[model samples]
Target: MRTIDRRPLALAGCLFLAALCLAPQTAHAHLVQTGFGTFYDGVAHLFITPPDLLVAIGLGLLAGLCGAAASRSVVFALPAAWLAGEMAGAFFPSSLALPWLTTVSFGAVGVLVALNANLPRALLVALACGAGLLHGFVNGSTMVAAGTDRLGMIGASVSVFLVITLASGLVVSLRAHWAQVAVRVAGSWIAAIGLLMLGWLVRGQG
Candidate 1:
């Protein structure tokens, strides 16, 4: 483990704390919360207009940055990967069973990323696939709930996020100076955010 300055780490820690404290109030960006994902009506509008797309892009970048801060460079791919995995799962029949799968899939991919964050971008694409599956499952179910077209909306959202994530990934990849260290620093932050998300998700269920 390359030991760097504690000052930066400490600074990052404070920011993480702030984000965690404020996250509860600010998580909803355009996407309305119909309570838990399981409780959502199927036809929720994703706000695909320019403003919404811009929001998605911004959030997608934020998610990537957060992931990179949390786990390392591996974290960089997480948001896109998770989004892809979750969304792909929507193509199939989604139910209460899907959330457990989403959790497990994310946990598994996270472990892999933690272990080999520097692996080629190609593998990162695979991670995105798994993420899309989970995303799709929940989305499809939501569409189903509201009697909306599942495949069409899922495709649109996936395209939007994919482009956003890919652009974010490129930005990270291009800044190759001390990239490993960068990944580690970013991964920790992303993990912090993920933990908060997990907590909120758990609370919603309870």
Candidate 2:
């Protein structure tokens, strides 16, 4: 039996993740892109939006750092809360606070990941639920404005859950010390980006 060396593969993946986290982001950019006004559009929109993509990555990293129990909690809480928020947003869609809320959630979760928070499972679930609500509301509001229907919203919610679950699973599967460290490094990069985004928002407002 031959054992394959997997360290290089892990290192490569970590580097790719770090690069993604460090990519430049426009502070005033719209977080949602118009899709085909169909269910698939919802899925495509989630992947195409940079802010949404990063938020999912941040949530996944945070959950992964907290371990399997926390990960499971996130998998459930995120989608459920998002669906609830989506339903709410479909009815009440105007939001001036979306940008600020997004930056805060991004920064807070990044900090937790960087610190490798070992929070109680309940706290992790609560955080995931809260983040999901904010994320889902923003997504939902955007979709509604784009004239998408409930089916589209459902597609978006499903995509959100799948993305977060996959990212968290990827990080949690890392068993090597260096791989774990890479996840933390990615978190730090995310936090720095969030801070920069906040500063940009402030400057624009002033």
Q: What TM-score, computed on C-alpha atoms, does each candidate reach? A: 0.43, 0.80
Indicate the worst ten consecutive residues by lDDT in candidate 2.
22-31
Model 1 superposed RMSD (Cα): 12.8
> Per-residue lDDT tens digits of candidate 1, residues 1-206?
99777998899998886554333221112334445452232223434322223333333333343444322333334344434543454455444433333443444443443343444445554555445544454554545444444444544454545555564565455456566445444434444445554565557641
Count backbone overlaps in model 1.
46
lDDT of all predictions, in order shown? 0.44, 0.77
| Local accuracy of candidate 2 as per-residue lDDT tens digits, 41-159 | 77777788656677788888888888877898898788889888878877897543367667778788888888988888899888888888877777777777777778877887788
- Report backbone clashes per prediction: 46, 0
Model 1 poorest ten-residue lDDT run: 22-31
Best by lDDT: 2
The residue pairs that clash in candidate 2, if any, are none
